[model samples]
Every structure is written in C-alpha cells, then in structure tokens.
Target chain A: MNPIRWLVGRFPTLALARRNLSRATLRSALAVTAVVIGVVAIGAIGMGGEAFKQDQLEAYEGFGGTATVEPASYIEEGNLTNTELSDGDVDRIRQAAGSATVLSVHEPTDALVQTQSGTLLFRAQINGLANPGEFYETRNGTIPDNWRQTVVIGSRIADQNDLEPGDRLRVNVSDEFDRNFEIAAVLRPQGFSAPLGADRTVFVPTSQFESGGYEQVIVRVDTRTGSIDGASQAIEQEFNAREQVVRVEQVQEQREQFTEFFSTVNQFLIGVGAISLLVAAVTIANTMLMSAIERESEIGVLRAYGYPKRAVVSLLVAESTILGVVGAVVGAPIAVGIGMAVNQLLLGDPLAFTAVGIQYVGLGVAFGVVTALVAGLYPAWKAANKRPVEALD
Target chain B: MAPAPGDDGVTADVTGGTVPTDEIIRGTDVVKEYETGGQTVRALKGVDFGIAPADFVAVVGPSGSGKSTLLNLLGLLDVATSGDVRLRGEDVSTFTDREQTRKRKETIGFVFQSFYLIPTLTALENVEMPRMLDRTPTQTRERATQLLERVGLGDRLDHYPDELSGGQKQRVAIARSLINDPDILLADEPTGNLDRDTGDRILELFDELRTDENVAVVTVTHDDYVAEAADRVVTLIDGRVRETEDRRANFEEGPDT
Candidate 1:
C-alpha cells in the first residue's frame, strides 16, 4: 500500500497514543522536559557559536579585506620593532597579488604628547600612512591634503587630551623630530584588530616619515580574480624570492581558526546535551514500559477486538514520538532566545540567525524524536508480543 | 459431552424463523491446559458444544469451572490445547494467528465483564473502533451511531466512560461489539458487576439482540436470571459439561417443574 493510506490506517493507534499520554499528564510532561533540555542545549550552543563567529569576522573585516602583508621584522618575539620596508617592496606585493591594493604604512612609534601648557599627557602610538583613508575616517574635520606638520589623532587620544580638529600639541617624536603639530582631524573609534594599536594611534602623512620607511602593507586581495589564500601565497613567495622576510596574515585564515575553535567547543557542548537526551530516552523507555504494563487489560481488549501486533507496537511508538515532537516544538524557540541572550551579553548584539543555526534546531528536533523512537523499541516489542489471555489475566 | 443428543446434528431452530438454521460455531472435544508454577492445570477437558445463528446460550458454572476458558477458545481469543474449534465449519486450529485475528475481527464480537472501554475515547469513538480498522469513516460512524441508538445510548455518544454509569458503559461496549455485525457474540460475565435491575435490563437487551440482529449470543454468567432468560443453558462442573438443557423446551412445558 501507499504510504499515505498506510498511515491513515494507523490513525487509531496515533489517537490512542495521544489519549494515553494525556491520561498521564505528569509522566508525559517529564518526558517532554527531557527533550526540551536536550534541544535547548544543542540550539543555544549552535546559534551562539554562529553569532560569535560572525562578530569576530566582522571585527577582523574592520581592518579591510581578507589578508594583510607586513615585513617579517616588524614584530620581534611579542613586541613591535623599528623595522622598515621600501616602497618598492609594497609595489612588488601589489604586483604579485595581481589586481590587489597594497596600502603602505610607515613607522608605528610611541611618543609622549604635551598639551599647549606643556603639561605631560598620554603617550600613544603614532602611525604614518600613505593612504590613511583606506583604514579610518574623521569624526569631525577631514585629513590634511598636504604632508607637513599635521596629525590626525584617534577618538581615544583626542578624548583623553580634550583635543579636536585644529588643536595643536607638542609631540616628543624622538629628540630630532620633537615639534608642535596641528591636529587635522579626530578619527572615529575602531575596535580591536591587527598592527597592535591602530585604534589609539595618531595618523600623519606617509611623506612626513619617508626616512622611517614603510613598516607594513595591508593587502586587499582581489577575490574576483581568485582565492585569497592563493593570492596570499603568491605574494609571500614573491617576497621570499626577493630574499625579503615578510609575514602574510590572511584574515580569512584567522576567521577559519575562529570557526574551527567554535566548532570544537560547540561539538563538546552538543555532546553533553546529547547525554541529557540519552538519559531522557531511558526515562521515556521506562515510562512507556510501565504504561504498557499498566494497560495490559486494555491491550488485551484491543487484541480481542482484532488489532494486530503491529498496531500495538505502532501505538507505543506514537506515544514516544508525540512526547519528542511536543518537546521540540516548545524547546526550539527557547534555545534561540538563549542564544540571543548570550550574544547580547558577549557581543553587544542579539544572535545573528544563521542558516547553520536553523539546521542545528532541525537536528535537535530530529535527535529528540530518534532518541525516543529508539528507546521505545524494546518496550513496544514487548507489548506487541504479549498474549491476549495472559495480558487480560 | 454425551454425544450432544440431537436429531438434525447440523442445524438448530432457535430464533423465530428468519435466521438460517445452520450451525455457525462448533467445538468438538475442546481441551485447554495451563502450566502454573511447576504443575499443569486443565481448564477445559473434552467439552463439546455447537451454536447456531440467533441462538442465545448461557454457560452457567461456578468459579474455576472453565466457563471463561471455553468462551475464549470459542471466540478465537485463545488457542485450545487439543480438539478442534471451528467457525462456519472451518477448523480454527488450521488457520494462522493472523488469520484467526482476521476471523475474530470479521465474525466474532466480545463483551468483557469490565466493559473494556478505552477511557480516553468517547462512547462513540469506542463503539466505532471495531469497523475503523478497514471500513470508511462515514460507514463506520453511521454503524456505530445506529448501534449506540439501539443500545439506548445515542445521546451519551460524546460522553467518556468515566462520565457514564457502569450500565451505560456496558451498553457502549455492547454497541462496540456489534459495530462489525459479527455472527457470534461472546460475553464473559457481562453483567457480573451490575445491579440486579441493570443486569436484567442487559439480559433483556441481549434477548432482543438475538431475535433482531440474528447473531448467536454466548454468555458465561453466574446469574440465574440470565440462564432462565436464555433459550439454552449449559452447566459445567470441574472443566466438564454436566448438563445441556433446552430452556425453551423447559419453559414451554410450563413452570410446574
């Protein structure tokens, strides 16, 4: 027979299962709670992981593009060094990464800034960029077109010194370079990323620090041409071929590392959740077995009424399935809510509902149902095998 | 089982005239035994009986006299240890378990002492269960409704078993039993839990069903009123039939005896 017709024939068993579950409200509720807890664990962890990954990827994207290339000696061990790269090196990187944009950065040095009164103020990193517009924008005035004695400070430095665009401050830029520079603009806040301290750094024209040379070059891989990893590899080879030591930090690779880390953590949490569901399965099995035993006479009556053994088994399975389905129905949304709550707490935003998160919810529901069905098999079989006369007794 | 003395041997005239007089159910030398702990106890030993269409027979016996065992075997709810139990002249022993279940569904009905109504379903749902296995919804519902009306429970169709009295629940069960219009109705101590008035009403209903529905009614009862109301009475003592009396003949001979 066709599947629809077969299922229609089993409607009575389904109805009977639902009715029996309703009859024992507390036991059914407990079984459903087990499924709820399991689904919640799976869904929250899955969705929360997605929100975290998206947050991290977006933060990395703040640096612009998929990968960044810098001289290998720019950082020594765990500290920034006074290493430099020529403009020719940046040009070669752009050539090797065909159709890519390479923005050159000069020395990133820390200097003590003094207010107009010469009162000692905060010491912050100073950055000189050939193309500063690629990384940041002004909150007030625009960056200076000329490369003389003007510096654009980040919001943190401006707020710390009560300085804004047009304000003048004397910087202790080494003994020979100490001078008063006009603040051309105050930059908008940028969250954490590469280059160590970009957010708090002051930006000056790259020409002002030509003697200092370029320390790093941010690579914007042309995804329209090919894979970012391939472009990064080619760029790194070009530098190595020139006998130049360089480090190519692919943002995509870092995002992948974040994804891999989240997946491992998610898997561990889902495993714990699965264990709870397993316990629930045992609970459901015990409940179904007891129900079958308690309803022995009722089963005998059904058997005497000419219901087949298969029908009896179907009835028991239907009971467990209903428990699972109902629990999932109640649990899925709560899991999403929990994910949102965690996202809001950790990332300052609600959970971003990703396609993968939806699939996890579906998996959770399927897991709950399969757990109950598998757990109920032995009990259903036992019930189906009982003799009518023996059951009636 | 002294050769079931009869002139026809195959047919019996029980109901007025419309019923076919052919024997619909027959059991020859039926024996049933059970192994309890380490000992075997025989529940039925060499019992012989036959029922025809529209026949109302009451099997009256003491507890442990195998009245229920005999009913179970005849209704195809249990297998006999030895001898043959036949439905429409075909031995049930030869049929597979599934076939026997099909036979039970198609040809036999049962009324249990406890009503056996699924408490979760309404009276109508309980009644409609028998035909719901294979019949269309409209046909099953109509038949169930008519049966409930016949049992004087048409208005109680939506009520659950817990909402009904014992007699009302039993009436629903009786309606459920007839949903498929079976040829034989096996009732085991059907009125065992009812009051005298309720029991009398149920017995009268059974009597009316015998003539009107033309179904053979076999009731295992301890109530003397049921035995008196039946057309035939078979008494059993210690797993053996002691007497089979034609109650109709005894009634016609007048109450003097």
Candidate 2:
C-alpha cells in the first residue's frame, strides 16, 4: 500500500519524461507518424483489393437462377459472346428428355447505350430468361420492354453527368459511329452490378435481346426437382450429335468463389498488417533505446535514492506503453475513416473496411509496447545497477 | 602515511576525537579497485575502519585518494573485492542483492556530494522518497517536515530542487538521508559544491542533527575545514589507510578487543 502511494506521489517525478521528450518533440512525432503512415497504407491496400473482389463476385453470382448448372464446357466461359440458341434447341432437348421437365434458355442482345458524361463500351451478357426479372429483382429499377435505341442507363453514367431521376443520357456501344443510345431511365447502384462509374449498360427486354442474337443455351433439368443432372445428361447426349453450345454447372461454385476470394484477400491483408506491425515493433524498440540513453543520468539518480530495481524497470516499461497506446489512439481511427472516405470516392459507393479488426488494433498496441519495453529493459536495469558512490562522481 | 597497526585510520587524534571500538559497523581488510581506461587502479587497499554509535566521523582525503570508494563500500552501494563488512557483527558480504538492498534501506542513509536530490521532486518529495520506498508513511510526513524545519527550509517544502540554492538542496538531501533513520548517516562530499557560507551552514546542520538524534555520522570530504568540523577524521592515501586523527584526544581507547 505504501509503495503504491509512493509511486503515485512520485508520478510527477516520472512526468519529467515529457520535458525530456520536448527537447526533441519533432523527432518523436516523426517516429509516431511513421507508424501512422504504415497503418494508412495498409488500409488503402485493403480497400482497393476489396473493390476488385466485389466486382468479380457480382460477375460470378449473376448466374443465379431457379435451377442452375455449369457444364464442363461452360465452366470458364460465362455468358458466351458469339453464338445463338433458338427455340429449336429447347425443343430438341425437351424431346430428348422423357418424364423430365426441361427449359433451355439462351438470352442474346445487340443493344447499345450512349451516356452524356462518359461510358464503358464493354459487352454485357444477356442473362437467360427462365428468371427474366432476376436483373430487376436482384437489382432495383425498371426493366426495358424490348430492344430499342432507347435504354435504361446505369447509375455510373448518372453520377458522371451529375444527372438524376428525370435525366436522359446518350451512350455509344462500341465505336463512335456504332449504334448510339438514349437512356430512358437509370438503374440504382447495386454493389458492383454496373462496371464502376461511367455507364454504357443497355438492359433490353429478352425478346428484343434474342431478336438481335446470342451465344450459348442454358439447359435446366428438373428430374423430380432434385435430379437436374439426369435431364441435363440426356440433353447433353442429344447435343453430342450437334456442336457443344450448351453447358451444366453445380450452381454453388459461383457463390463459393466469392467466399474464397474474400477469405483469401482477408488473409493476405492480415498477413501484410502483421508484417507492418512487426516493423513498427522494431521502430518502438529503437525509440525506447534512444530515450533510455538520453535519460541515463536521471535513472541513476532515482536508483541512488533507494528505488528498487523492479520499480525502475516498471517505470520505463509503463512510459513506453503509454507512448505506444497514445500513438495507436491517434492512428487507428484515422485509418478506418480514411479507408471509408477513399472507398466512397473511388468506388462511388461506401466501402466497409474489415482490414483493422478490434483484436488486431489491440495486437498492434501490444506489439509496439512490448517492443519498447523489451528494448528499455536492459538499459533500465543497468541504470538501477549503477553504484551510487561511483555514479555521483 | 600508514597508520599504526591495529588502529583503524578514520579516527582523528584531537580533543574528544577517538571513537569507541565496539560499534554498529566494522570494515576489516577492506579493498576496492577499478579498471579505468585499461589500467587497474586500487582505490581502498585493505583499509581497516570502525564507527561507534553516535560518533560524528569525517573521512578526509584528497582527489584520487580513495575517500569516495571507502564511502561507497561503507554505504553498501558497492562491494569491496576482499573484505568483511559487518552490520551488527553479522558479515554482510554473502547477502543477496535483495538482502543487501534491505540492509541498506534499513541501516544506511546517504547524502551525495552533488546534492543528488531528484530534480523533479520538491524538497519535501525528495526528503519523502526513501521513507516512501521503505513504506514508512506515518513517520514520513512528520519526520520530513521536522528535518526540513531543522534545515531551515520548512516553508520551502514544495519547491523543486532547481528552485533551491545549493545549500538548500544539500539540506534537502540531508533531510532525506535522515528520513530513513538509519544506524549511520553517510555524507559523501556533502559540501563540495556549496560556497563557504552554505557549506558552513550545512555542516552546522549536521552538528545540530548529531546533537539532537545521537545518530552515528560518517562524512567523506576533501576539504580540511569540513573534516575539522567532525569529532574524528580518517585519512586515506593511494588506496591505503593513513593516519587516524582524533580531533579531540581521548584519555584512553575504549575496551580494546
């Protein structure tokens, strides 16, 4: 109890440490900023990778429908770009199936969009019509009635033009002389549905899209609702006599890729954060070592005055921990906020950062503090061990 | 410069100077050495010494004359390479670091030459440090106040070391050493850095402290005037014991062992 009281009473004495820091405040602040910049850099990398993976996941899950399959042939090629699957293809596959319900779908489009501000003149898959409302259902907005020069524009184009609900945009699909489009309505932002800011999305009605052209057929089979592969195989054998324009999929790999991509990205960023923290640890160690050197005489006096060696060590370690904790308090929140802001700017949408977890922030502080404490240990102990009679000289 | 055999050299040959042989501390065959710049320097070479209860003794020596080394060894701040340093007749050489610290805390008080009060602490806090470390809170406040009052800085308790004069800082140092109430108070060149007037006042405080507390006082000083203030003076030369001057010559040495 008395020792505690004494330490508290002498807390003012320990605060002389601040005067010690003020002599070289700029250098100390620079050291703290080094850790801050590292954290910010880590947050930035985490944000960019989040954007890329989200885009890829949306592209993958676009294959979601009532009964989905990806055949070995269509395993890699999503939404074949240069072929056609007609009602004849559905009829032949149905005739081939006995006692099985079958729907062979192939959505095609040759529509273009022109925007007032800017546009992405890339190809968009005309997703199959078994789930026609999937686009309007998965994403919120009005769907086009048919393929016309008029098109529903993506929000990216709207944002670029500074346009809103009643505004119309013009966009060209491929080259400047290709088909131009006038936007009748703009779509809402749904994750990464439209390729980021700048839109040339033309979602035409299925019939209008089929009237233009398409690449592959999706063969859906309902063998008692659970045996999709049976009808799929019979259709495949029938198509074996023809060119392999159709494919089957397990329907879950699309979602699996999303989980895997995010998990992989999360693991990679955490690894980088850990490595950066390790470097910060070294920085803390160096700082404490230099500070100890500067305060050796002060330490000697404290020891000479009957301060137990244990007390001296604890004082030094506690001082360093306070430094690290103060630095972290200044850094982590700024990083989280900066991450959110940059994501909102570049992705034109809010980006949530799971890069710095609460546990990780705690770990970062521990890393920094432990580093400084360890570095200060030997020096503090040496100070305590100095012979008072010798050191007074 | 070697003293007569069997005579511990710190006692001065003057009126009322010789100390009683049986005392709280005894140093036998004490030797201290240091390696300075790759050369072995012997500081205290087999210096025999003794201090009796309530004796005010001053160890006087020139620079490089081992006075400080002997002080350090006596204060338990450093170890003598080959010596038997006893506390109350028990050899303290083999004690653990904790044991040594406990001994020092309980039995030793130190006043440094430079007035090594903790700079951040006020005069009161500086006096209060050891008592706090030793966990003697109840007596700490009253004793510190009384000692400060004795040193004539009772009103300046809250003033920091830098705010005080050199003598004031030494007085605070003196107050701190007494706060422990040790068997012996050791002052290492306590007045070295003070002006003559401040030095005289500090020595006067030591005298008053001696008269009031009956505590054994050992002061190591380079100044002849400082040594003259003590009842006994011990001289050291080239790491060896020299003359032990009894400042006030005694009729007989007490009960020679």
Candidate number with greatest DockQ:
1
Give the best candidate by TM-score.
Answer: 2
Q: Alpha carbon lDDT of residue B70, candidate 2?
A: 77
lDDT by residue for model 2 (A273-331), tens: 65765576566567766766665655655565566677667666655555555567676
Which ranges in model 1 have alpha carbons more than 4 Å from their true place?
A: A1-12, A64-247, A339-352, B1-21, B246-257
True contacts kept of 2: 0.22
Q: Over the stretch B109-228, how does candidate 2's per-residue lDDT look in tens digits?
A: 888777667665679878887755444555677889988998889899999888998888888988888887777889888888789998888877766665566567788887788877
- Cα lDDT over the full model 2: 0.60
Check candidate 1 and list the clashing pairs.
none
**lDDT digits (tens) for residues A1-393 of candidate 1:** 556544544575676688899999999999999989988878877777677666666666765456777777756688876466777777788888887767777654555667788877655677667656666677988876664668887877788878898888776655336778888888776544444345577776666663646777777765666667777889878877676588888876766676788789878877887888888898899999999899988888888888888878888999998998888888898988887787786567774567987777788888988888888888888987898888877
Docking tier of model 2: it is acceptable
Candidate 1 overall Cα lDDT vs. reference? 0.77
**Lowest-sum lDDT 10-residue window in model 2 chain B:** B248-257
Kindly report which residue stretches of model 2 are placed more than 4 angstroms away from their true locations once superposed. Answer: A1-71, A74-134, A137-142, A157-178, A193-253, A274-276, A329-378, A385-390, B1-22, B133-139, B247-257
Candidate 1: how close is chain B to the reference, as a TM-score? 0.87
